[model samples]
Target: MTKLTLGVSSCLLGDEVRFNGGHKHHRWLTHTFGQYADFVPYCPEVAIGMGIPRNPIRLISTDTGTRAVDSMNLTDDYTERLQHYAESIVPQLDALDGYVVMQGSPSCGMERVKLYNKNMIPEKIAAGLYTGVLQRHAPAIPFEESGRLSDPNLVENFVQRVYVYHDWRTRQPWRTAKELIDFHARQKYLLMMHDYPTYKRLGQKLSNLKDIDNRGAFGQAYLVELMAALSNIPKRGHRVNVLQHVMGYFKNQLSEKEKASLIHSIEQYQASEVPFIVPVALLKHYIFLHGDQFPYLMNQTFLNPYPEELGLRNPI
Candidate 1:
């Protein structure tokens, strides 16, 4: 696979572009995941002419909506400038599979940034001005805050979505009905694990290709819904359900003892006694040995969503 290209906050990449002339420097992004991806850093604050060591900005709730303004001097608003900068980069952002944003930043935070009211008190939480515009313009792209990557489940989910989106982007599957259906087939189990209802719904939608009037519109809408479904972190029960479904395929292949061991591993994972990777690894072993007999199971993305070397599923 080609290396993924990710849009990242400049500060998170160790660039001293912060208001305080410092950096948020995320080590895992720079060292580990960086091995599989090339970072395209953007510092909206700096991009909009806010020099290093400039006064910090914060989100303020105005009568119209949220505004980015100088924290100390709220009169100096930068909302329009930040929004314009994000808008101008729409073409550049299209090349990225995902984005890692700085949390609590007025310019780049993806979510839960403080939104202060007139009395200088934080009244609510919202996305930063820059990221808000970008998300609106391209809702299909996977966006995760740097702070949220600390959770193993979120990390795994984010990376999975990145790979799926990248594949779709590069392959342009929607060009033909067969190509689109084939792509969906590969993602069936992964989608089922995240959202079973959506999984079934999307399949039904794709069942009748002749009904699609505009392939481009249908494909874009399909991807948007698919990404939204994938955004839901699969509950342990949901994962167990998918695991059992996959195990069903090997009913005749595995001996009684082997089947019992696989069952035990799944049971341990379901009960939270072990990490999810343990059972998944066992299933992969069986799939490797018996893949020729069950080609469908071998192509499922749920079995290998991202590169195993990342070990993203270990903690969850």
Candidate 2:
């Protein structure tokens, strides 16, 4: 598979783009996730003609409106510059599959950047100005903060979405109805794991894709809904449901003892006694032993969403 293109904060990759002339330098992102991604790093503060070691900026709220202003000098507003840069670059990043942003930044934070009042007292939290525009322009793209990537569950979900997005992009301009249907079929289990109801709804929508007057519009709407459904991390209940469904494929081939072992593994996973990998590994083993009998299961992306080396679902 081709490497996914990702929009990332420059500092996350060890670039000295911060106002203090120091980089945030997240090692995991640079040395690990970096292997799978072609990163396009941006620093709105520096890109807007601001110098390194420049005066800091913050989101300011007042009777007029909230503005990105210098922390020490409220009059030095860069709101328009940041917004312009964000809007201009999004169109150029049409092939980007995902984005990773710095947390708590005034111009790039995904969420909960501090907003201050006219008196310069911190008030509430809001998204960074540049990120807000990016989200608005490309709402379907998967986005995560570098700080949140430390959580295994969040990292797993983010990586899954990125791979799914990249796969969908690689097979574009779906001229034939069969191509889209096959794509949806391949992603069925993954969608069900995230959100069963949306999966059913999207399935119904895709059924009528051939009848729709504008295939492009229909495909875009489907993409939006699909990505939104995947935004939620799959709960343990969802995983249990998917595992049981997958096990159904081996009902005839498994002996009584093998069936019992698989059932026990599933139960152990449901009870939180083992990580998700234990049951998933067992299922893959059975599928490997009897893959010819169940070709559908072998082709499902849910079995191996991302590279195993990432160890995303290790249950730890």
Report the C-alpha lDDT of model 2 over 39-68, residue by residue, as the tens digit: 998898888999999999999887777699
Model 1 TM-score is: 0.96
- Candidate 2 regions off by >4 Å? none
On lDDT, the candidate that comes out on top is 1
For model 2, how big is the CA root-mean-square deviation?
Answer: 1.5
Task: Give the per-residue Cα lDDT of candidate 1 at 25.
Answer: 99
Clashing pairs for predicted structure model 1, backbone only: none
Instruction: RMSD for all candidates, in order, please.
Output: 1.4, 1.5
- What are the lDDT scores of the predictions, listed in order? 0.90, 0.88
* Cα deviation of 29, candidate 1, in Å: 0.3
